[model samples]
Target: MFRLGWFVNYGFGAYGWNQQWSGNVAQDVARPQLFEQGAQILENAGFDYLMLEDASVLYDIYQGSFAYAARRGLIRQDPMPLVPLMARATKHVGIIATMSTSFYPPFIAARLANTLDHLTEGRFGLNLVTSSPHAAAQNFGHEKHFEHDLRYEMADEWIRAVKALWNTWEPDAVVYDEANGVFADPDKIHYANFQGRFFSTRGPLNSVPSPQYHPVLCQAGGSGVGRAFAAAHADTIIAADPGIDGMRGYRDDITRLAEENGRSGKDVKLLHLISPVLGDTDEEAWARKRAMNAAADADQTNQLAALSYISGIDMSTFDLDEPLPELSDRVNGHQSSFSVFAKLARSGKTLREILKSRRGQETVELVGSPQTVADRMEEVMEQVGGDGFLVVMPFTRRNLTDVGDGLAPVLRRRGLIRDGYPYRTFRENLTSF
Candidate 1:
């Protein structure tokens, strides 16, 4: 009963890092085009969806300069356009785009999501996020980012408003009854009249409910409030837990929260991120992993800079050989990343040492032959309970093809992952498992 999806970061120079040495010559084509092709591959592999993790602004926190972020081309484009492109390219795999509830107004989000859901025939999902970066606040004309828990509160209101708008038009509102001299049923439509401290929307969305009723809601954050938000609202929780025990604890905690909120905890699907380096043999996979790491080492400066960008901590000021300095009591960005790395840093390990450890570097790793990779995934899912995983494909097209051609078939034959999607809508496909 394990499921799989691709964790695709679609903005900026997403695959620019992979173009350095990968065998994919198509890197010359536009990234959006390449992304569409990749989506097709994932659909053929029976992946549930391809989610776009996004960052809106530049990462200048590392050294008080945008030069590093610009040079790396980290994440620079709007992620919305790619959604329809992906949906048009494939029929089954879901398309998820990231949008910030803190920044995007409820009406706009509702319209965009509803439109995309219809275009994809109910295969669209929204990964709702609260803008995390301090600079992002400046872009939105706010003095500073909202406090950690408060952002979630704002998101809660945003969800309520958006959901109310979606439900305003009942399912039968659009009844093209020509014989009755009416194009629709007036009683079927009603105003939302939703009012909240952070957001309020009146009346129904212009469009009727899409095939899935509402787009599948996804939440991905590494903080306590984030967990609560996901447990209460999201159809899927894109978890980034690296170890079995950690994964179990995260799932249990969220499930309990869901129950406390008077909802079934099992309603939230947990998907942990893993990147596997696959080969015909274990040694070869390890070799490939080392090569990939070496390439990353060449750009370690940008890598660490990007880390600073996400963690909201300027890592550049610290000496590589010195233990990490004490971080803030709480980070406004990815709280878990800061907490986890800080704990590792306290072992008296140098910044360099911590990044070098598998625990620090790889979020979730499985490097081996097909059988070995499959075995590890099965064991982890069994130990961690239910839900599934999000596979991080190497930026190279070859690695992408290798995953679909090399590993997915093995997973299908072994019955660890599904061979085909049984439902038409994304939520149905997810719940069908």
Candidate 2:
């Protein structure tokens, strides 16, 4: 049995305006109702949380122009206000908001998360990140993004400072003792004077710690520094290591790091990414899966453009059949993602082949009838010593309906998904393992 979560590519959805069904939901991106509808669907499914993935920079790296991104609308509005909108729509489902340490100040991040914690009634999570886009730096007034290790160094201090501010007011500090005329205990409220390499905060956070202390910290760490950063600070780590062997190795390494860092390995959850194509029968499911993979042209093109944008090379100009040259120094951002792409390139995969592979890269495909999918999920969890999975499927009402009305029912019958949330707070439910 394992917990499940949904990852939203909020920014990328803006680009989905070109889809066939885009006309029907033209305002979904701009409107709160659409997001609320999706949140409600997940809650009905007994999903743990909806993690909103965000990126601030308008990506234009594909061909030294923003044409692909803008034309496709691969941009996003601010995600801050939408947090409460989603919160108001659901009671149990946690709301995970992505915020960047590299871009935002420590105190702002702390205050925002604490406020969201109160707003969501302890059902909020922070997907803390060290941003790695070229335009992100420029947008934030920086000449260039920090190096990979340096970014994590800033993030380490950023989190430490934020947590210090969050811990400024003890839980017992709030006392509505009107009879005695005492509002709160001053002794329990202390000032946070934290000074780190990247940040220094002085505060008793106006918003007291929410039910979960600080919202659950969800991190996606892929590189060596990124992994150590997650092991040191994250409560749940989102990973993309492919295959049973890769997953087992990742789990072992992170769990070991957690223990060596003075925490129980069980305290930290590891969730790998999965994209499943579900249907009623094995034949239909397999057929659907093949169609989806064959429909990989969009991902292949969009991702190649993305690869070019991130790796600082116009892959659009490269020979689709030529073996990719060594890119030891070309990448100036997201070394981890570029490294994965680079490996595919170095493996003699053509540009076309690489993009197609990217669509299914780092995936644990769970395609079959609900029962069959659940069986495969069980096998994967057992073999890899699992925490759980984060699923990313094509966005459609049917996609969610199938998972919620179809797959979840099957999982519940098998005693895999939870019958109900046992605890109130997101952290409590998330760490219930």
Candidate 3:
């Protein structure tokens, strides 16, 4: 059996606000009940983790206006506060929150991660990201975002520093010896004293070492530098490449990079991002997929706006009826995402055609009955020499039930996925398979 995770945006985004299945999520967006319930459902389904994707800025790069994004509810709430709430609601399912290395100081990030790990009993994972949007940089008081490779370079140092801080309190550093009037062993604790090109931290962390010592590191880096950073530091890597071949290639590349970095390839789990459209029957599933595609085609402008926000390019400036011109290599936003968009453009298809073809940007879609989808997932895992799949979709009650209640049971019965978590910590459970 392989691992399973859920990828979701923790925001009042307009994603499924109009859908009946969404229930009162839109009305109760600010409340934690909905998310807590969702986390419980996933935990009961035996999912390895739930990953929350975040952004710190209101995007305005689409048509040089924030109106489209704002209307679509692109503005996001901070994800950090939601971590403990969801963690309290679920026992086994890991909660991974996206945090920006570009903005968070090493000491603060380490402390927060350590605290979350303790609160979650080691079910917490941190998805380290180098914030890409120039608007995000501006919000953090930077006029410009760092260059693609440079951001990764800074992140590499940031991870090193954070890890060093996490290590300050050794595993055996804490000892409650009231008989000796000693709370902790001072000899076991050491200063981090980390000084790197981009970050510097002095002294050890204040807290005792939590379970797992260092919480699980999660990352999604599609570019070369990003992949290298992930390979060296991440425990689980998220892959968003499309197609079976692309997925296999990405896995292979990460495996190679891991080995090159003096770590065993098997030590890191790679979860490919997928959006499965499941129905009672195969035909029904295909119909749902078609409807999804139609909705996307009708909302092409919003689609472009989202792409513009991520790529930091004014996609509205491009001619929809004509093929896109070669995009510059100097994107200050997500370079890998921009590269994927550029590749689609170079396919000689018109901009509108490209948008229409991509129903769920870069995420592979599995459309079929529950059993059929489970079969396809197994086949893909085998072909990709797998770790697992991360289900990327809008959060709705119906959507969650479709996968957690419908699809997961099929996978479990077939022994293609775990029926229950057997390990104590998330890292152990995730790596068990």
**Candidate 2: where is the Cα deviation over 4 Å?**
11-16, 20-23, 309-312
| Poorly placed runs, candidate 1 (over 4 Å) | 10-13, 18-31, 297-299, 358-363
Inter-residue clash pairs, candidate 3: none
TM-score (C-alpha) between model 3 and the true structure: 0.97
- What would the TM-scores of all predictions be? 0.95, 0.95, 0.97
Residue 181's lDDT within candidate 1 is 87
Candidate maximizing TM-score: 3
Q: With candidate 1 superimposed using the best TM-score fit, by how many Å does residue 155's alpha carbon deviate from the native?
A: 0.6
Residue pairs that clash (backbone atoms under 3 angstroms), model 1: 12-76
Poorest 10 consecutive residues of model 3 by lDDT? Answer: 9-18
> How does each model score on lDDT?
0.80, 0.80, 0.85
Q: Residue 40 in candidate 2 has what lDDT?
A: 89
Per-residue error (Å), model 3, residue 340? 2.0
lDDT (10s digit) by residue, model 2, range 1-433: 7888887755325523556434455767667776687788888888888788887877777777888877776767777788888889888888888899998888899999888888888898999888777678889998888877888899998999999988899988899899999988889998899977778889988876688887899898678888888899988888887889888888998988898889878888888888777888988999987877777664566667767755667777787777776767336666666777787778887777777777743447788999899899988989999788887754556666778788888888888877788899998888887
